[model samples]
Target: MTITRRNLGLLGAAGAAMLAMPSVVRAQAPRVVRYTHFQPGRLDQPKHAAALAFKSTLEGLTGGRMRVDIFPAGQIGPAPQVMEQLRLGSLEMAVVHDGGISGTYAPYQVFSLPFIWENQAIAWKVLDGAFGAEMAEDMRRRANIRLLGHADNGVRHFTNSKRPIVTPDDMRGLKIRVQPAPVFVKLVESLGASPSAIDWGELPAALAQGTVDGQENGVTNILAASLYQHQKHITLNGHVYSLHAYLMSDRFFNRLGNEEKAAVLQATEIAKVIHRGMTTAQDANAEPILKEKGMTVQRLTAPQIDAFRQKAQPAVRSWLEAEIGREWVEKLLSATRAATAG
Candidate 1:
């Protein structure tokens, strides 16, 4: 309670000691990132592969000042919940599919317009260009989530236990499981299949239990979830060029230091490349992969694919225009056309 010369001297000495150990005084706890994805944490899974690359590259870039903790296969929660966590900054990052994103940013469903992309190359060009940048900015503003980059979810194709879908007519009367997105629902309906809105996690079970006769997904997902075990046939319709969005919480990102931010952005781009490459390879070899899995694989000719496009494209596009507005619909159409032309 009394000021003493001895106490004053001791306090001064402590201050001097602290000053002498600058590194100890200046050291801060590492920033932790809680990253998540829907796929299992296996090297074979594109999402997990990309996630590992991201974690290593980011930590290395930041000299361990930043740490990433990955939660794969919905360990944190389901897609909708995970997305909400990201938006609220409770989760730092996610590599979410387009269907998962649609619940948060409805306009993202514009990408669900069937058969728009001629090939993965055309899709990549549009996603890596101004159109993608614009969409990212808009998503940041609307959802409080930053879209770092886009990767392939795979070019979606139809698989069924009932029949090989060679034409739109062949799709009739079968119940197909689709992501719980309106565009996908409309797409299946347009092809004359009865669509059952099923969660991705429930898809294999749905097919196995005969809750749905078939479902559509990319080759990467089919193998990742082993849906091929349930579905007997796959048609290489390539109906939709699906996407996996590299997303970060804007709240978390905005608080980062300049150098940390740079590292994250660069690391995300690297992950995006890995994710895209792995998924694209699987999609390119869909027939062989599905056949190896002991499923019947049907490869469509150009005319057959065109028939699918004619049937489903307009229906899905119309639904998208109605839900998200024609502006985004047209924007995607124009972007794809430009990408194809180039």
Candidate 2:
């Protein structure tokens, strides 16, 4: 076959075009993040809303080069399985609670220690500062996870169908559902309640079926899960200033370029603020909402709260020290004092 100069030039151009196609396709393909959580994927839910905000900001910052796919309401699996996935690098990210991680990363249990923080002001100061950095480093070393930031789970409070729980004695004879953690079990038992270890996924059913008379959780959680429907009374005991952890796979994080890493971290901070704001707003507005839903919401005065704190704190702190160590407990107490002192 005879080839002309024009034919040869066309062939070269076609070869060059084919060679460039792969790079074009690679540039267009977005990096996907599988972000999972165990909360309702609704705008009204703080965690879910924050997840959306994170997705938007990260994508925007990356110029659509990054995309996040959110899985909420335990769609992937339970907390333990999801956390395990993150550890194994099978999952990209998650917003798990302190109780969920305490078993694997024992230091996270510090947040679960009842009556540890006097109020949210003191708690945020510690969590958003040096203590938080230390915990983040510990988590990176031990759990192979990067702590992006802390979001609110809000201060856990007591809710029951039986009666108002103003004092420790009022908790007596009540079958209280606690997280399947020794710390929580001890906390409830110390308050004179019979503690039943129930999974959060099963809690609403347990409360509805009278398998347990009541349970403890943050107002946002109770509201999100609609526990107010089953529980008649709520006491703002503010037992534990619990938090939700925003974590990324350290392996994944380390592999990212500097710009990508910055986008992820900055997106996390923005999302953290959004999450905390929603949670705090919900907490502040909870009593009225609960009342509107035909449930009795009781606000404990300083003396009332102090009385329960006096009875419960020492015992729970001792339990925590025994479970984790005296060192962590002492460090936490010192940090708490330093963070809150005038």
Candidate 3:
């Protein structure tokens, strides 16, 4: 049909509207981030809670210019996979533990050593101080991840279906599931238990089927995974004071504007406090809860814990020195001692 003047005017308007839409959409779009972790999305769980805190704070601080989408409970895959995603900038951020991060950066195993800290106060002192800053920078440079803060995995303890662990001698022949990390393998073996390197996803099944008679983890982890249903006894040997590394993809971090980077760091600091408090409270309150669930929970006396520490320390330290360099080991120990000194 022949076009009229009025029809030509209408067609011109429609074409202009279409041409302008792309710029409008780009102007209104928010910068999105994908954050993930292995923990379940329970309000009481530290990682999930912390992620929520970050999401809320970041959106508020950025006035909705940034959006953080959280995926919990291995929604993006296990810790190692998530870690790789973070490295490749496929994932924006994650709260990964020593077990997950160590696979990429071997020196992270330094934190997995047995009895490194006598208590949380000293551990926090070192980690929140300059030493921790140095370590974070080292990770940023070497591993392509930015360490935002350190949260707790709680101090790991031993639990077994076989018997209560009073002494290192009691661990003999017991097949104990451990994170698939050499430091953990060495820690368990040095204490005389046969270490079965199992992925966290498979641990509950491993315990339930007696594929492994025992495992060592924080009380929160034991409770969260319902390992108590399978394991009858728990020994709070407190061998390894584990940590959660709150990390961001270095690629994503480097691309952020100055104000956006500042807001992200501030939000993480806020989250670090919330996360650490939750885990600390869990460690304090878990014993009674475990016992009420009908599992025998034993809190090791000072000497008993010391005994296990003595047994595990030499072999594990030697391994660390050999594997990660004596210089780094000594440097960490020096920092710990300085933190502990009055």
TM-score of each: 0.94, 0.94, 0.95
lDDT of each: 0.91, 0.88, 0.89
Better model by lDDT: candidate 1 vs candidate 2: 1
TM-score, cand. 3: 0.95
- Judge candidate 2 at residue 96 and give its lDDT: 94
Prediction RMSDs, each to the true structure: 2.7, 1.9, 2.1
lDDT of candidate 2?
Answer: 0.88
Can you tell me which runs of candidate 3 are displaced by over 4 Å?
A: 1-17
Q: For residues 219-258, could you state the per-residue lDDT of candidate 3 as single tens digits?
A: 7788778888999998888899989999999999999999
lDDT of 1 at 59: 99
lDDT of 2 at 342: 45
Q: Cα deviation in Å at residue 244, candidate 3?
A: 0.9
- Candidate 2: segments with Cα more than 4 A from true spot: 1-20
* lDDT for position 269 in model 3: 92
Model 2 poorest 10 in a row by lDDT: 110-119
